[model samples]
Target: MYYLSSDLFFPSVSEANWDGVLAIGGDLSLERLQLSYKSGIFPWFEEGEPIMWWSPNPRMVLFLDELIVSKSMRNILNRNIFTVTFNQNFRDVISNCQNIERDGQNGTWITNEMIEAYCKLHELGIAKSVEVWQDKVLVGGLYGIDLGHVFCGESMFSIVSNASKVAFIALVNQLKKEDYKLLDCQVYNPHLESLGCREIDRTDFMEMLKGK
Candidate 1:
């Protein structure tokens, strides 16, 4: 494992380590976070662990124009029963996603330090969130760091059935309106694939990042 230097450039990230994990044990400073997002790498690690950076091979991303709204989902979208908003309640959104009971993670990786770091990023306009609300309650949402033209999704959760999907749909639509190019889901999973996420080589992904 390479020891991280604060002065390293994006090009130093090893292509062979397409897992996107180039270095670790760095502080979550705004500069580091900014550089990471700009290069398509973000931090992901639990408390008591060194800060782990990841850039996975076959990057999973959801193109705004390609969001797959299924027949049932289309009907849900048409109903417009849920209220969708952006950056309105970021802490609430993050807290909701941190709910281990809903996330199914035995323990939460969103430690206090991580929360404060991202919250600081949000304050600086580098991180953003989309929230899904029903009956004035926050049931689902998603959060991530946003760089030039890409939003790297960190985590999402749903308290009510399909609520997280609703939040994702709102996020994609908003990105489309803003002319954003890509929504990075970071790692691939069945749930994301069902919603139109596809994998691309990290090399290709970083090339696309340069264009953005």
Candidate 2:
């Protein structure tokens, strides 16, 4: 893989290996992170590993028009049990995402450095959060980079059943109202697949990022 330096550049996404890792050793500066997402590349590595950038061949994404709300989710939405808001309590949202336990993961990728970097991005209005509140309690939420037409979802967490799902559905509805195009999910997971996210050719995904 290509090794990054202080010049603020990345190798072409086409150079990514079979596993989609394109480069390593880049600092997660705001400029680098913004440029990475704009180019359809993103950082995803373990806590102690060097910063690794990837541009997978089959990119998982959700086109706003294609978002699925199953009958169960529809019922939950009708109940209006959760209050959703945008860019509200971003730190809390990200912190929850960092601490919430997952099914198979032993640790979190949202390290302290990552959190500080993204929080800086948030201050610059380039990063955003979707908060799900239950009777004034921050029960669930998600955070991501807002790249104009696309929202590059980073992480989400739920303290109660379907809380994150409620936040996601609310986000979809808001994006639809604002005429946003795609939600970059990064990789395929059954959870996202159930929410109507699907993998498309990397070329297609890149083109979408360019508003093509």
Candidate 3:
């Protein structure tokens, strides 16, 4: 794998190995993080491991127009059971995502260092968050990098059933209203697939980013 230092640079995405690991050991400085996402790369590694940058071959993305809102989800939205807000409590949203337990995971990938880095990005308006509240108490939310026409979703959490899904649907509708081009789901997973996120060649994703 390629190794990175303090230099503000990244190798071509084509240089990524079959597993999609492009480099290791880069610090998550604001400039680096900005460059990373703009270049269609992202950092993902455990707390004890050096930062790993990835550009997967088949990127998972959601076209704003293609968002799937199931009948149940639409009903939930219509009921107005939860309150959704954007960029209101980003720190809490991300903290919940970091602390929430999920199936098949021993520990969270959102380490303290990662949290601090992304929080800084949030302060700069580069990162955004969505909060879901019930009875005026935070129950679910999601966060990501906001790249104008493309939103790079990083993580989401829900305490009540379908809370996160509600937040997601609200965000999609808002993005569609604003004429966003895509929502970068990063990688494929059953949860995202069920939400109308699908895999597209990295080339195609890159082309869309270019148009951004």
TM-score of each: 0.92, 0.98, 0.98
| Tens digits of per-residue lDDT for model 2, 75-187 | 98898999999998999999999999999999998889999999999999999999999999999989999988899999999999999999898888888888899999999
Model 1: per-residue Cα lDDT over 50-164, one tens digit each: 8887778889998788899899998987888799989999988887777637435577778788888889999998889998888988888999988758888989988888888
Better candidate by lDDT, 2 or 3? 3
The TM-score obtained by model 2 is 0.98
- Which lDDT tens digits does candidate 3 get at residues 26-78? 79999999999999999998879889999998999999877888998888889
Question: Number of the top candidate by lDDT?
Answer: 3
- Model 1 regions more than 4 Å off: 5-11, 15-19, 102-104
Query: For model 2, which pairs clash?
Result: none
Residue ranges of candidate 3 with Cα displaced over 4 Å: none
